[model samples]
Target: MRYVVQVFASAFRIRKIVNDGEFCILYSDSDPSIDCIYVTDKWILSNQAKPGGYYIAYDNGDSEYVEEDEFKMRATFVDQD
Candidate 1:
């Protein structure tokens, strides 16, 4: 499965993965219409973060844009468990 996520000003698809207690990483290898983010596989598993959805994952776990109701239109994104 794949999910459309928006991070800041970019949008990208995240290939879905089962949240097992193992390391996982998400990235892109070409000119992506939206930039992809790299997260330690362990991070996702540790956080029990579900895949194949939208979220607002950030260093501070805060972003005004994502808080807006129009977030879905701007870019579909996420990283919260």
Candidate 2:
């Protein structure tokens, strides 16, 4: 299963996500040590960073738009699996 996650973050980090050859690993800006989520290259809609956030369109037609702060809080404890 794959999901499209919309992420809000710095340009530098976003660039890194886009350039990564394998997959997109979302990291928390406040705590760089924490990895928020992982999106494989197969599910990515586009490598380009959009104005609102990083939009990843899911294959099942379900997508999520999350701000950096909200995502950090959720990713801290919630098991995405």
Q: What is the lDDT of residue 70 in candidate 2?
A: 50
- Model 2: clashing residue pairs? 4-56
lDDT tens digits by residue: candidate 2, 16-70: 3442677665543333444455666554454333223433334565545454465
Give the CA lDDT, 0 to 100, for residue 81 in model 1: 20
TM-scores of the candidates are 0.32, 0.29
User: Which 10 successive residues of model 2 have the least lDDT summed?
Assistant: 8-17
Each model's backbone clash number:
10, 1
lDDT string, candidate 1, 17-73, tens digits: 433344344442222543455456655645454444333445545422122234456
Clashing pairs in 1: 5-76, 5-77, 6-75, 6-76, 6-77, 23-41, 24-41, 55-77, 55-78, 56-78
List where candidate 1 sits over 4 angstroms from the true fold.
1-13, 17-23, 27-32, 59-81
CA lDDT of each prediction against the hidden true structure: 0.42, 0.43
